[model samples]
Target: MNGVLFDSFQHNSWATKVLLKVCSQLSAEQLATTAVGSYGNIIATFNHIILSDARYLHHLSGNAPEWLLNRDLSNDFAVLEARADEAANNWQQFFTQPVDGEQLTILVSGDYEIHAGALIAQALHHSNIHREQICAILTSLGIEPPDIQPWAYAHETGRGRDLPSEQ
Candidate 1:
């Protein structure tokens, strides 16, 4: 389970980097321009992704980093990129160590019970959904979004490869 979870986190981080790299090419106006059906613009959407990961990590760890607590969504691209990188590194470190999968109660809007593993899965799913939305927004703006598929990520990272068929 940990291995799978780790892979998912790795893919998530890889995809984020790819998207951010593509977004870096956009002009300031494009980065901030609002698009229909998106959180706001490319920068805003990326900020949401970073903040969401921070919130989940805080719930799981019972400690919120000062930077995360005081994050500004409208910060410059470099700041947002650093925050996203930090969040990804944190998740990598977390899964590299042992995690307690036992059920724990958290107070969000209300008290809810969940396990560590489930929270990780939720984070991964949430990121992917938002990533797709960002991709759609990029397409609408006539900018080609980078491919973020997990299989593509695996192939790029050399962590996975096609196997020959057994006749």
Candidate 2:
């Protein structure tokens, strides 16, 4: 996979973790709040994002981490953060490999097959979509949402830097 193709995965993980930390501070009641057009309440949306990311990652790489395999998934902040970090590492390794974008991922149960490239695209879009939904929930609750944008990720991770005045 090219750098840009994979780098977004890192950003997705980072941004999700960032937002998770922010949302972790909310009370259980607050976490249950929902906004119009969102996928679900804050807790549900966040959990869906984490769990579903692993689903796509698993299909993409044919390897699933313990966090993905374990059935003890919950809305616990610590568990979510741990899973997110583990997922980030896995995603990093996955990107280090050559990507066969044109390869087909067979789905016998569903009687369907999807291109790896399309799955990858869906994985990227899925996280962004859910994150926005969580942010919308926060906005509706009068809580300022964290900036989980790619620009913010770049700034935080030093992927982006201000160019000093040119000599």
Candidate 3:
């Protein structure tokens, strides 16, 4: 894997952990609160964000398995977290294997194709944007989000801190 892609995976994992921390801070009652009424509450928005990104990531990689299809966030944190872990693992495994790094076609939609690296980049970038939203939700709820920057973790734990900064 390229250095950039590897860094992306690390960052993605870090961001994911931080989001989980934010979610962990919520109470069952607070988790369902809709601060703005129209924003669909914290749980729903977080659920949609995770599921939508996973769906698009899978679709772009030509691996849109039914198991990874849309899901309800209200189900349970365990289920949603499991699915997220699976999605992240799938991406990680794919990254572990060597790709041409040159170019490869992926199913963008009905008969559409996009470069693999570009698609992966899109997925990572898009998720990070939503992750920030999740962090904001945490702050609004009076919960602090972990510092996901590489330097923070490095400065805190040296090298063996944790695989994902969230942990």
Among the numbered candidates, top lDDT falls to 2
Over 1-167, each residue of candidate 2 has an lDDT whose tens digit, in order, gives 45777568889999899999999999989998988888888878877888778878788777887766764567899988888888778778888878888999974236778998898899999999999999888888888998899899888899898889988
- Which residue segments of model 3 deviate by more than 4 Å? 33-40, 70-75, 101-108, 153-167
Off by over 4 Å in 2: 165-167
Q: Tell how far residue 148 is off in model 2, in angstroms.
A: 0.9
Tens digits of lDDT, candidate 3, 1-167: 45557656665665675666558657887776554433466677667666766776666455654554534454466666676777777667666667654466655555866677676777777777666666666667777777776666455546445466674
Candidate achieving the largest TM-score: 2
Q: What TM-score would each prediction reach against the true structure? A: 0.86, 0.91, 0.71
For model 2, the local distance difference test gives: 0.84
The candidate, 1 or 2, that scores higher on lDDT is 2
Candidate 1 per-residue lDDT, tens place, 1-167, comes to 56767778889888988888888888887777776776777787888998888778887876565776876565566777787888888887777767877757484546787887788778988889888888988888888888899989988999889999999
Arrange candidates by lDDT, highest first: which order? Answer: 2, 1, 3
